[model samples]
Target chain A: MTVLATPQPTISASETGTETVPLLEVENLSTEFATHAGTLRAVDGVSMSMTAGEVLGIVGESGSGKSVTALSILGLIRAPGRVSGGSIRFQNHGELLTKSASEMRKIRGDMISMIFQEPMTSLNPVFRVGWQIAEALRLHRNMSKAEATERAAELLERVGIASPRKRVSEFPHQLSGGMRQRVMIAMAMACAPKLLLADEPTTALDVTVQAQILDLMVQLKEEDGAAVMLITHDLGVIAEMAQKVAVMYAGVVMEEADVGELFDEPLHPYTQGLLNSIPRGHSRGSALKAIPGIVPNLLHLPTGCRFRDRCPAAHAPCGKAEPPLQRMPDSARKVRCWLHHPEPPK
Target chain B: MRNYLLKRLAQTIPVLFGISVLVFSMLHLAPGDPADLLLGPDATPEAVAELRSDMGLDRPLVVQYGAWAGRILQGDFGRSVVLNRAVLPEILKRFKNTAILTAGALVFAVIFGIGIGILAAVFHQTAFDSTAMLVALAGLSMPTFFTGIAGILIFAMGMQVLPSSGMYPARGGDFFDLLRHLVMPAITLGAVSAAILARMTRSAMLEVIQQDFIRTARAKGVSERGVVWVHALRNAAITIVTVLGMQIGYLLGGSVITEAVFSWPGLGQMMVRAIQARDYPTVQGGVLLIAMSFVFINLAVDLIYAWIDPRIRYS
Candidate 1:
């Protein structure tokens, strides 16, 4: 493990206070679920930021709170689950967490939109594809129904659906899984949002279709100059698309760095384990070096480091207290491991 | 869609036939002969026997059913022995009254039921939700007669706000007067069905709100109202409409109690009087009409199902 041997300055120091604002800045975001057993601090004090047209991938195992963090950014958390603490600043809108519902409504789908995992269930089954897409247009842009319908048809064509006019009138069930996902993308991009929170957008699609969706997303992001917060468990997806990467485990950021550096020289033990576990054809004969224990249950997490039990490099400090995410001295990376203890906050 | 409707209509033939046979057999199997009821107690056994043959009640069960079935096919429902009137015309007159009462009650049921149901679901886990659901539960279990009588006692007798019983035609064909008397019966009959519809709507809304599209809707900045009302409710409506159709069917049969309690002069009350006097033709004709109406209502509901969901139409 390089462990940020040569520390470098992160992007935020110079980026903030500049004339242009970074597309998104999520600070100290803490999400919790009020379950029957107990309160689960799902996303515990996570902080990640992105710039316009940038792709920031949040990669984690199942139940690691990556999706929860994305939902927090959108203020989309439902009852029994909530963003207990956070300030999500998007473009110029200050502290989205504190925005009134009506204000939030104005920002949602217009300035910030979302694409979900299951395309099959993500589109309303009853409505025509044209009407569904037109809905976003009408809500945010106040476009007349006729204009929105015509624009929806154009969007369908843009998403590569054949015979856009005909497909626009068809129901969601009439489309294939890939086509449904394309429709979802069209709806998400209808308003040309500045930031798109896509929680596993291609996870439910076939291998062949996943590439097409990823490519379409990249093209759309480039065209609109929109930032993307891509939440996925698939590291390959992150490597293929993201510029920066944040590795989350047990509701906290274990490590974050430029995508290339994070993949090549992982600083955190958890990040190393995650990267090593990916199946490779060259290593076919050897058994996969799977991560040691399963994720800790959020409701009854261990007293010290949440991943301590599962961590291979766990030691005395790991048992005593959980490590706060410490920024490296000269590196543009952050890790919440005890070995890289930076100056404590005064 | 047309083919599907034609197929559905064809299927109803068997169902209607079965209901007719059941209605006919049930009346015949019951004790108390119609001839005996028509003739006085002072009449001799021979006189009763003469009346039985005159009324064609002396024939075998199969022969009697065939003759009655043939007449019914020819649009002759025979006549009411006790009422001394043609069965078809008397039932039709009362049918109009019942139709009005049912239509009035349905308007009340659908409006309040769906509205309150959506409110309860959107405000789920709140005091309004709990209380509304509780009232809905009561509505579901409480019989129509109980509510009908209670409405009369409270609104008519105690408050003197609305008339207690009967239609308005006797009081100078006053349309508003009919409405005044209609208030209690409509509410009483509609309450249970409303509760049923409300409960179905609440659960359906609750389920729909949890779907992935609802979250997608919120993420896209659709207002919370639009999310719940537009996106979630449209999906929930699929289930809600199915139950509403069933409620309409069940309410038709249940209207009997409500009509009798208020003496609204509808088919249900007439049927009650007919059953009491052992009027076989009126009872049989009324039952057949109700059974057929129920089937047709369900058919209408199925079409509505297709209309609400594009998925259902193709299947």
Candidate 2:
């Protein structure tokens, strides 16, 4: 893997003796979906925290419940899917899980916002791009139509769209995919939200456009100083953008560490497998190390560690019981494997 | 836009010509002669022959069609053989009455259909949605004429609340009174169309509600009402509008049966009377007018589609 050493501050103000709190704190979050077979536990007791101005990258394969965790935080899960248990507390906003629907409405788009994958489908096709952005301003900022429209054009320009005044009147279908994503970014940044949840924002774009979008996100993050939770399966994105990383597998966090520490000495077997699977320049001709087996079905997950089926280092004790996420001694890293447990099984 | 409209208008000529030819031939092939029907059975054969010859029925079919077509081109619909009045004036008089009933029924259909449809969609799979769908299904299965008869039996006979037949009561009341007389027939005529509109609206709303744009709207902190009505409903409108257009054409064409059941003095009833009397010119005129109205309504619908969807532009 090509590791880009991007400088990011890992410590928040609270750690520097200030009384500032973490930007977001999630505890024991569980989400379920009702199916004909039974209740499928899609997200099983996952928890993480982020501080102001931090970029926390969550890396996981498909069906690992990364997106569900994001949706659960935003309270966007709909019928057949639900957040069964959890306490999500923001710095200024109280427990989000306990907030009324209307209270959540006020917080969303104003205090926190989201940018989704597939910009082509994320925007309302019938509406003008400028109008869409202006809608957020009008709703949250209480700006007049003219003022909101003017600000929308300014936002479009800020997101590097050329001739934003002209682009404002155009509908989404008339714009290119890259332009649409820029428009989405402009909309998400409309109210200067304190936190932004980006779910694979560049997965659908071309590589060149993806680079540009990432650069734009970095620039916006610096300018606004808003905390972001970036969710993706691409390890390269985590190396380039994240200060903290969380490795998730089958709805459980397999490892959580500072990005540098996690890359240098990945403690969990699943995290080690993930890092080794990445092809390096020196090993171009050699067979890449691929993780064995797929993610277990959430409805019938094994009784022990969820990754035991695919772990190359599994032994007799691996299947005996589930492993708890425990902090390592003399390190700010956590791993959910028996090998890292204080007393390893004999 | 102008060019497209002109082209659409030009296309109607062929349609109207085909209709005229079809109506003329069908009336000619039917086993009835206008002169014989007009004349008494006791009349002599010489008298019947003189009457047919005077009325130009003795001419060849092609010649008679040519004469009728030429007069139509000059804005003359010939004269009604049985009524002994100009065909154009009599048809216009009846068309006005049918237009009133049709318009009333259409208004009722749109308001109730769209309302019920939005309600059902917002409620989705809830009990309200199921019950609304069931009522719509019932409406779809029952024919308008059957509903008209049933309406008359209940409203007119049992409750004695409404006048069962005619455009106005025998006492000849005012406009509101005419509207009162119009209620049962309009509801009967509008029921099936309303059901169709509701179902279309519900399906369209369901499809639109699942779109990513709806999710985006909800994420923007827009209320559920705004998400459902403003964001989802507008996207779903193209299908609903198309269905409404089709229903409008059906209403205009199908109102004849409703008109007949209620004894309303509309072109439908007049056409039925003309067909029974073997009045070829009057029948031809009425059918032509109805066909033209249908074509025009479809044209209006096309224009409406352009208005509702920004992607659809007339060049």
Please provide TM-scores, in order, for all candidate models, with all chains considered together.
0.92, 0.91
Instruction: State model 1's lDDT.
Output: 0.88
Task: Report the TM-score measured on chain A for model 1.
Answer: 0.93
**Model 1 lDDT tens row, A1-346:** 2134215446443443432667788999999999989898999999988887789999999999999998888788877999999788887888899998889889889998899999999998989999999999999999999999999999999999999999999999999999999999999999999889899999999999999999999999978878899999999999999999999998999999999999898988889898889998998988888898899988888877888898888877777788898888888889898877863222
lDDT of 2 by residue, A154-256 (tens): 9999999999999998889888999999999999999988889999999999999999999999999878878899999988989999999999999989899
Question: DockQ numbers for every candidate?
Answer: 0.75, 0.72
State candidate 1's DockQ. 0.75
Best by TM-score: 1
Residue clash pairs of candidate 2: none
lDDT by residue for model 2 (B1-315), tens: 566567777887888788778867776677767678778678789999999999788999999889878988887987898888899999999998999989988998999898899899989999999999999999999987789999999999999999999987787889989899899888889999999999889999999999988888878899999898889888888899899988888887788999989998898888888888778778888887888788888888877776666676423
**What DockQ would you assign to candidate 2?**
0.72
TM-score of 2: 0.91
Which portions of model 2 show Cα errors greater than 4 Å? A1-19, A344-346, B1-70
Docking class of 2: medium
Worst 10 residues of 1 chain B by lDDT: B168-177
